[model samples]
Target: MRILLVLVAAAGLFGCAALPGDGPAAINITTQDVEDSAQSGDYTVVTIDPGNIDAIRSYRPMAFANQFRGVGRGGSPTLLGVGDTLTVSIWEASPDGLFSSGDSGSSQIPSVVDEHGYIFVPYAGRVRAAGLSIEGLRQSVQKKLIGKAVEPQVLISLRDKLSSTAVVVGDVAKPGVYPLPLRDTRLLDLVAQAGGAREATYETVVTLKRGNRAGTTRLEDLIDYPENNVLISPNDNILLSHRPRTFSAFGAVKANQLVPFRTKSVTMAEALATVGGLRDERADANGVFLFRYEDAELVRRLKPELAEKLAGAETVPLVYKLGLRDPKGFFMSQHFEMRDKDILYVSNHPTAELGKFLQIIAPLISNYSTVQRITD
Candidate 1:
């Protein structure tokens, strides 16, 4: 009997020591600690209420598609530039005109625009072609040949484009400098010409760099929103990149693992569901937490009152708590947006440790009693 009691007591003590709270890295945190942490100036603790939900939703980054709404569609004629090749056809009304060739009274001249932005014609010296539209250049040549030729008529068209080219590189199968078409070329047109993005649409990010400004949008957004497929300009640098967004699930969950979102946006409830939901037997319904670092400027815009209270906190490491004990908490989870690199943790109930201790000793006590009765 003494041996049975000793064995039972040892098992109980071992189980208690193996509990999560007794470890150096404790997984269990009380509500008091979460609330006091903010007052202690250790970290910001945001209890997700209706007001907090509104603030967080308001501060989330706007859809990449929204930034491209103002981008204009392709319709404008392409301007000529230096290093472009032009094919000019000039016709003379008279048989003895300067440009006459047998009964045709016309000549086709292929000229490349020089560094001086001018192209030379047979009788019309050097005429400016760069920065002028095809029709504009034709009129300029006709004006020059008015007295030199008999009722001169001219037609100008782009033979080749060398100076007006855009660099389409990064995450593309055929990345290179692509020439801008005579008609305005839009974003998707250039991408398609370059063999499209190598990565999946949802995982791809497209960045457009024009002069000193740069803008980024998801490739899926460009495909879904026609307005986002804006016109591409000369010398624009286009980059396609793959950056997958993911969140980590830890503690008391069905399966603790890094979960990747298949869509551009995902809600907290959906993220929890993806990790197989919480482990019902061990999970503390009131101790679910989400950890992330938020932008200070965004916080200021969304939660000005809280922003003022945490003026000195620069890194803005925030912990958002949700109590699933209430039925409405599940509804609130639907509204909470999950961001990249976020940590979702569901702690175990305090009584669960004692339950575990009991489980470990119950079988041992039963076995010990059977042995003692047999010996008696």
Candidate 2:
């Protein structure tokens, strides 16, 4: 009997608090409340009220920015390899020191970087040359030719690179790591290397990771601002995630529900198409709604809050909603961006909230009575 009652209460908790009539109900969430909770340093659900879009747009997290750019900075130091090229020049050495000295137009041998990331010298043996920079490799050769020739002067450089690579995964055309053959590999170059993201993916949502941490960057931003189109670094990993497909449709809609669609990037018009749309036959189109959760707390945090609220409840719903179709009704679908684990709900037509409340309570009471009777 006790177990039965507990189960009943649990179900009631999830399906309760419904408003009056058939259509969705009006939802009210205050920006002040969210801010106050945030200021208190509580990592709880920071319910973003309808008017908070501007705040979200302007909000910047420096931690996230630093995480992405860090990838290009921590690669392992190594030598150049095969299929590599370099342009070498000796400062004050004689004809033999510079391959073709005095700009003679090189009548003898064709000078070019080798495929093995190495360069050949007249008497210096085959010195490894691929990975190192121009000055870096130069010092290396200078060190190697100590007693070989008369003050054997040496200078080595990377004239051409042929061993660069990067990995692409998640939502791209061909999800795998690829090799790049140039020192100057751009963001778009990698995208091309991977064959681009899948058709179901949002091209704008892409992330890059160096090691453990990752950062998000927009495709448009990289195109419009070349600086964001970062240069590729060796051993760097790029992951592309697909946006979630769930949305909330509320207000004058016939049935308010958390609906799941096949793809992400859903428009207000498309969301409406699901669940039979605004019960124009019975709903108020102007009052259609979608309640989204912005900055919802993780599931772990919700459990403690529910325990405190219910005194000893086993579980609780730690979710908050913001209605979109209220003031700037039409803007609901356009400006709203859906994220993972988001909640979408259509509001009840005025009278539905009460009916929902009664329906929820009735189930609980009946469940309790049935349990008691069975026990007796």
Candidate 3:
């Protein structure tokens, strides 16, 4: 009975043997095995160094000027459309002229473009205004009243624009459809008109949809890069959203939390620092790994040999190792940027697992000896 009690206590304590960074034997993969697999073309592995850092930077997606070319610009004036209100003023040279009102020989007419793109004039009849600029419509009205009126001079101006507008929604202080002005209105102008984004600049993502085409850009980049704030086109839909970039930290890091980047880009060192760095006692200094899915085209450009192994893959799974034991590794970490959704894992020191096993069994051994003494 005494021996059986000791065996039961030992078995119960052995159940707690699993430690940090320990996994099932079938799934356990060592750092050396990862390195060997990368060398054998089973997976792409990159060492975080100055040259590789520059290569990764080259592959980083850049925000270019929205190349959506259409009708909205300074070169082309705002054309008339349905539901647009216009003010027409006609002037005559003589007091007894056709539009004489209280001897001023001028009249102000308020007209709205109809469904058929035409506006009515007393003598000019139904005149087509849609698809014509303000100046163009003025010329059309003058030509219609040429024979009837005495050398009529016409001027036209937009009173209220209703048809030509862009819809702004999501993550803004005010979400509504804003009308585009007669002059060229830009993307930033429309966003400002809607009361600006509710989130931080770095956290905001602005997507522009024009017709069937769509483009997305970071709000911060749009503000910093002038070209990204392109002219807003009619019927364009602007969506402002907050999608904060983050990366996951696991294994022997001091704090294993989903860390968010405060800026557009964060270096590996910055990410590690944000998470309180690696645990000195448990972390294996040479086993830091960053896991991410990289674009195949970029992989091909950077490492053709690895690219060949992943020919059929759209995106290649890549793991980058950083040896913190080396004095120069700290410098390399500063250059290596941590992309969104990346996983930063620091494997535990091999001896740490053995120490944990000893810790769990030591209590069981003491309990067993105490039970034996009681039985005796």
Candidate 4:
């Protein structure tokens, strides 16, 4: 009886509250930590609801598809520019004319557009070739050589394009420099010309660098949304890297590690099921938490009260809680979209904390009971 009294007193030491278990409990998130307030990281808790599921889905990570929209892919006419190699053919009606050579009445001349955007011919000197199409430049040369040669007929053909080329690198089957097409060439078309991505579209990330600005998004995003594919431009550097989306699973789950997203997206319900679900013996069903960092602009729209509080902050840390004890929570989880690098944690049950305490002191209680038996 004395030993039993001592055990009861020891259990009473943890009165009003259970012992600290694996990670913070759902109740601890909002309350202040009286002992060391600084230790508790600043974060906001958001409850998942049907009214805001669409808004949550709208704001995803690494989606710079907006940058691609309205940029590049203009159907501009391809003209002869500086560093362009051209083949000029000149024909003369008389054999004694300047362009006539032996029995042949025509002579072929290889020329290059100079830095000043002008090309020099045998009879026509310093003709403006830049910004002029093959047919347009041909007419200009013929007009210039009208009096110099005997009925000179000038023909201009683009031998090589030295400018307006883009570089394709990383994860692509053919990584090299390619000239931009005359017609409208979008991102997908440029990628196709490079022999496509070596990795799966869903598993690859496309990074486009244009001048000083650059944007990154999943290759799958460009494939799924045509508008986001945008247009390809000269001097644009494209890179395709393998970046499989994944999230970390921690706390009272069956397996504690990083879990990969198999499809284009994985919801909270799917994420939980991926790791064999929460542990029935140890997990607190009411304390399922998902930790993420969202843009401040999005947070202001979702939670209007936070507009003034988060000044100049780009991203705000948000902890989303879902209580499975409520029958509607299961459905809410289905609507809750998970982003890359999200953390899915299940808090330990209060009863489970007690069980752990009991396990630790079980040998001590057994030793005391054996002593009592020996004394008796």
lDDT of each: 0.78, 0.53, 0.78, 0.80
> lDDT tens string, model 4, 1-376?
8868786667756642566667987677746342232224377677776767678877554346655555565333498778788899999999988989977788999999999999888758889988988899999999999888998888877766665677899999999988765677778887898999997888898899877678987887787676667677777899999988899998899999998888877889999999989999899998899988877677767777767777676677777778898888898888787777899999988778767777766777798889989999
**Model 2 over residues 3-91: C-alpha lDDT tens digits?**
86687667656655422343334343222353344335332343334555455444332333445564565332345666555555543
Quality of model 1 by C-alpha lDDT:
0.78
Give model 4's TM-score versus the native structure: 0.79
What count of clashes does model 1 give?
A: 0
Better of 3 and 4 by lDDT: 4
Point out the worst 10-residue segment of candidate 3 by lDDT. Answer: 22-31
Which is the winner by lDDT between candidate 2 and candidate 4? 4
Clashes of each: 0, 44, 0, 0
Q: Measured by C-alpha RMSD in angstroms, how accurate is candidate 3? A: 5.5
User: In model 4, which regions exceed 4 Å deviation?
Assistant: 11-20, 30-41, 58-79, 85-116, 120-126, 131-136, 148-161, 225-227, 308-313, 374-376
> Judged by TM-score, which candidate is best?
4
Worst 10 residues of 2 by lDDT: 294-303
Better model by TM-score, 1 or 4?
Answer: 4
Candidate 3 structure quality by residue, lDDT tens digits, 205-245:
99988777777878877777777888887788999999999
Q: How would you order the candidates by lDDT, starting with the best?
A: 4, 3, 1, 2
